[model samples]
Target: MCDKNCSFDLSKRHLLKLSAGAVAFAAVGGLPSVSYAASLTKEERDAMTPDQVIKSLLDGNQRFIKGEGVEHDYLAQQRTSQQGQYPSAVILSCIDSRAPAEIVLDAGIGELFNSRVAGNVSNSDILGSMEFATAVAGAKVIMVMGHTKCGAVQGAIANVEMGNLTSLLDKIKSAVGKTKFDGERTPENYAFVDAVAKTNVQLTLDEIRKNSETIRDLETKGTIKLVGVMYDISNGKVELL
Candidate 1:
């Protein structure tokens, strides 16, 4: 057999035609074969210790801060995760655009189960989802992440009311009492806002512990570990506890 670079005998061989797209990409590294690319063979989800899971998030945050990330295949990962997801961790975060759990953590599909709500509140449903993530979906760790300068935290702080938002903000009211800093408690109060964000995550963590029996059992047996973190949007780093 001739080498891959060997030319075929022109007089004896028939011409093999290539598609326009293929010919166009022939100058480059070769256009990706759609049929082959669509196949989801590399479904290896890495194993991570609970502590490693936490550290990985922090490292990813650092990458995000530096404007670097592992931006990868979207459709391929989605197709692979269509049937099942083996995420390494579960993140309960506030539904703030600036605080997106996946991008800030530099996570790819099937990497972490993200549970987002206003103030990252842990009601029965959120707890249930987290329970499913760890117990059923095989997530090794759970994270309650809250961000700085949060509108929800401010709304709760200011006691703003509109539609059902009253009730949603009410869930964050507990953090006000938890904010026992040496200064005032208002959004203008940067120290207070910062404290509120931290307290909110810690509070949500407690709520998760209090509300979910399944998660509690998992935590007790060390099958899963729970942690709280505050994401600073300005600097893009997670302060984990």
Candidate 2:
């Protein structure tokens, strides 16, 4: 080897320039370079299969559980979805701050059309919203999620009451009555509270299936799938129901 001794040899520099030029040439010709989306739009994500869609959501939840959540592009996403949204999932979850749909599911913009209320009940307005999500907006899946140690569920178990909150708590009473725990019916009984939570999610899912004609038709046609989930606040694993 000739001793160029850490100096930039002209021929070697020229070859380096040639290599870079060839790389630029190939990139310009689009020879399998990455096609990144600066932001996801409704039309851009249109080609995903059903299994792919579910896997995407599950991956996001994995990230969330590990606290490796991605940075937000919410304003950019809001602008992109201003025209329309083809959300992949319709989520019915509790309104607990810790159980926010995006954070819990680790979904990005335009991923889920979320509908949350106490007990995740399927009232008329919620059913209407879900109908729109599945029928009008073309969501692929509907998830009804209940959380552990839910205050509403506890209130229902003990018959707790307030002015307007009474009615809200009353909605959950059905779950309490439905839950057949051999022990006491007090909030102190963790088993009782947990049972009611699961029962409420199941009951809410049943109500959605029975009441919403749009969802029923979609389910019958195999156009959409409905499932229930339970979020454990202590340990972030979402148990699929």
Query: In model 1, what are the clashing residue pairs, if there are any?
Result: none
Per-residue lDDT of model 1, residues 16-100, tens digit only: 1234343334324453323112211112222234655566577778768888665556686688668866777889888888899
Please state the error at residue 155 of candidate 2 in Å.
1.0
Candidate 2 per-residue lDDT, tens place, 1-241, comes to 1121322211111121233434334434523332222234444334333444455566567768889665656776677667776677789898988788778776656668898887777789999998988888777678888999988898888888888878888878888888888988799887789899999998888888999888999988967778888888888878776
The whole-model lDDT of each prediction reads 0.71, 0.71
Residue 202: error of model 1 in Å? 0.8
The list of candidate 2 runs beyond 4 A from truth reads: 1-39, 43-45, 49-51
> Which ten contiguous residues of candidate 1 have the minimum total lDDT?
7-16
Q: What TM value does model 1 have?
A: 0.79
**What ranges in model 1 sit over 4 Å off?**
1-46
What overall lDDT, based on C-alpha atoms, would model 1 receive against the true structure?
0.71
